[model samples]
Target: MSERPLNVGLIGGGGGAFIVQPHQRAIHFDGTRRVTVAALHPDPEVAQAEAAAWEYPLKGYDSYDDLIKQEAAKPLGERIDYALIVTPNHVHFDPAIKCVQAGIPVFCEKPLTLNIDEAKQLVDAVKEKNVPFAVSHTYLGHWTSRFARFIVKSGLLGDVRWVDSYYLQGWLAARTEDSGNAQAEWRVDPKKSGASLCGGDIGTHALMQLRYVTGLDVTRVQAHLETFVGGRSLDDHFTTYVELSNGGRGLVRASQIAIGHKNDLGIEINGTKGSLVWRQEFPEELTIRLPDQPDRTYFRGSVSANDGFLKDLPEELMAEPNIPPGHPEAFHDAFARLHRCFEQDVRAYNDGKPFECDGSKYANIDDGYMGMAFIQASVKSSQEGNVWVNMDC
Candidate 1:
């Protein structure tokens, strides 16, 4: 007999929130998981009304505390299998740590929490609980990302030397927050969005892409967090010169004040022998340039093993399920892939089996902590006259 579907609960995703929609779709992508309960808003009436009007049937609670307390008290199989925390930066740590303490697995949005201290606490709670925890680094779900990781880690790139990883956007080129834009409003507010705006918002995506692909950590950084837009306390443009764990140097930067660039996130890693380039705008393919050889481009669902520089493709990577080439896997597909991988770990945890919440599949608690640490370090570095700061703090 087939296994029953996993039931998911939402801590926040109402009040016209944006990230929650894609997450809900990703949760239901495989039909093996579904959202059954939610604490949609802080206001009890608003939460109930929103839940009642949700696209599907679901129970709603006034707050995450009530939801966690009630659901966690239930016997296994009767309660939500896991919780998805889709709240704002300030709201993340409380519900997430509570869920962890309640022995509920959590899939949370990125930047982990508002600051490194909260992130550290969440990390400790997760470690103590030993529950499955995943941070939603959506782009890491791309097959091309995994493929890039393989190519670089497999020694095909011949030791990484330099990297340029960036996420650029024009959305905040002006003061959109003053125009009643909820997303823009909170993001520019330091109390809600944390210390660095551009860096915490999308810079971490660029940082994670570089780390995910190169398998290297940024050890130190000299950063410049600039607020190009007047009246914003936090930065609209963030740049950092980083020292990698392997002694190589690179830049991990992001800009929200760049006009005409819409979600233009990309990475280029240059090594001693070859280089690899990938752009999220063109998610379907990755390019590799090697000296004295024709530039080789590999598309999703079309790569072959034993093709000159590419050899012995891992059976697992090759067999990982994806739509056929030309079907075009995009944003929702990437989100679904993350949820799909996360589902396996959740199921394993549910079964009391040895599960892998390793960073290989999805961003785990450690990766989340690292992101927080990176942001903290970058902010400190910028505040100290753009001086280099060690990441150990």
Candidate 2:
């Protein structure tokens, strides 16, 4: 690891923010990345309260530009190495471009920016600076998900035939958009949410997860996106038929108005010889079905069942010292593990040593651009009576 800690300046993490707590916890989970929240730019009162709650004592600013300037004035070694962008979709581009242009790396939230044009600009900025960047596609770090990738790579599945994935949530079932809920308000507004709500927000997660596991690029997409709630401008539910680059077929569906469904993101892959099923709700288990034998359940930390990736998980993340097998680890723990890997890479880069996990191994600027393209293609296809549109990125 590096001899010096990487001082991190957070752009938008305030009190009552849903993601601020998790971001702070994940950053400090590993001792290697000593993240000092040098500056926080939120509402003055909210920022002070959040700083107190997280015990961050460096400084607090209401102006994002002032924070950037203050951090830039520090000595070379003491300057911020990265800025975490966790603001709303509409607020993503400016801070991201500013940070990258200032020669600081960025760990941006999903969707990159509000629209394709903004995303393209950010992508160009990253390339121009040649600074390391990453997007938080945390599912790529799940033990079982990585194992699924291994299964496909091992050819155990034997020429994958199809993939089915879904991400459903019921949080916005009601007219929360009309009720002025800040998160839902911006999410349902076309100005802030962009073209397709369901596709832009969470459908990107499903697509990224599927591509990561199967190593298949989407060649084309035929989509039907809808807004069920009255007076809503953006789609609340979306379904798409996908053709993969390797001649495989797939289906993706995401809905926020699905009643009684809470964070139910699941994927099922079918191959010539066998099949695999995994659900985010029960993230620790992977169901496998073989041609001849009955179905088997593979747990995260199982000795008899786990593949190389699962067995190679950090010792502390294992299920237990001794048990029958097939114990479960929760989702937050998986997210923490992803953060740990990111921290290792940051430290390695600082120390001029080989990074543990390649930043490109996870999502990056290209993935963000692809996601924007997916959103645009889905919206266009939906508008054109579910016609197929090429997403050859």
Question: Which number leads on lDDT?
Answer: 1
Clashing pairs in 1: none
Q: Highest TM-score: which candidate? A: 1
Error of 2 at 236 (Å): 0.3
RMSD of 1: 0.8
TM-score per candidate, in order?
0.99, 0.89
lDDT of 2 by residue, 1-393 (tens): 446556677778663557756666677655545556534545666665666666645566656676677776776568777777887778788888988787777777888888888988888998876666778776766777776777776677788899998899988888987776788887888887788888888999899878878878888999999989888888999999999888999998899999999888889999887898998888778888887777878776664534532234444434422333355556555556666656556655556666533433467778888888889889999999999999835
**What lDDT is reached at residue 176 by model 2?**
84
Q: Give the TM-score of candidate 1.
A: 0.99
RMSD to true structure for each model, in Å? 0.8, 3.5
- Per-residue lDDT, model 1, residue 206, is 93
List lDDT for all candidates, in order.
0.93, 0.76
